[model samples]
Target: MARMISAPVLSQEKRERYDAFRQERTFNAYSVGNDTVMTRIRHKSLDCSPGCAVEATLQLIDGKWKGVILYHLLQGTLRFNAIRKRLPNITQRMLTTQLRELERDGFVLRTVYPEVPPKVEYSLTTRGQTLEPVIMALKAWGDEHTTFGHVPEICADMKGSPTNS
Candidate 1:
């Protein structure tokens, strides 16, 4: 013997509206009983294409401070204040949000200790360690190309080619 389960049915108009909502690329919503639940659709099913690969990687690290945060974490485990000191420009709220996002994405780990002041430490996970090469390459490129603290000037001895010098 077997038991059959029944699902709640939506009216025709509601079904059409739900279908239209599903057509959007950003998010999808489902109705359960008297409440509606919304879920984000982060990315489409990857088809093993180059564009898909790049998109997936960018989606995982798609924030202004995420890459920099990961770069700092590569050195070693750091407390919240230590990370904040490294990035003095970042606000406490922004750092908290970024850390939460990183933890949610499985790239960073947040561990809390039972103590009088609640010691919390942030460190990179195994998956996050794989980004070392990428982060290092970016750092190298910035060191060579960026003109942050130096005066900008045009080169005169070059003849239209970098190898000419």
Candidate 2:
């Protein structure tokens, strides 16, 4: 048998705050025994003034591996090992963590097949697909600005500029 716990009562002010917060953000709530836990799924904050919108967007894809993961997913669905192969530098644990976070935030869909060893596939969700332009723009920027083993043209031009002094 398992013991159950009841949710604590919130004060009137606290309740109002809770409601407001819920209105601004998306969350998934589940019960652990009898206690309810709210997990944040997205940070759609009501305050999108000035840099807040950019901040909220960044919060969604902030992890180092997230953008790269999404970029690959844009090509098509891939298995866990395939994704790992593309990101050779990432550890298995880190990849798992980033995938879970992306799934939690509605950016990735994880499908598991009941098989002898369990087959798992990950693909981007519709919400995740919406980031295609942003991701591609980032890729374009990197392609133009990144120089693998040589100085970038921009750096060479800056070397002789007044600011370089």
Pairing residues by index, what is the TM-score of model 1?
A: 0.64
- Give each model's clash number: 0, 0
Candidate 1: tens digits of C-alpha lDDT, residues 20-43: 655442323344554263534434
Taken over the whole model, the C-alpha lDDT of each candidate is: 0.79, 0.82
Please provide, for model 2 over 1-165, each residue's C-alpha lDDT reduced to its tens digit, 9 standing for 90 to 100. 999754556468866866765643232433454324354533465385677777778888997999999999999999999999787779999999999999999999999999989999999999999999999999999989996664454455534653553
* Shift of residue 3 alpha carbon in model 1, Å: 55
lDDT of 1: 0.79
Q: What TM-score would you give candidate 2 relative to the actual structure?
A: 0.63
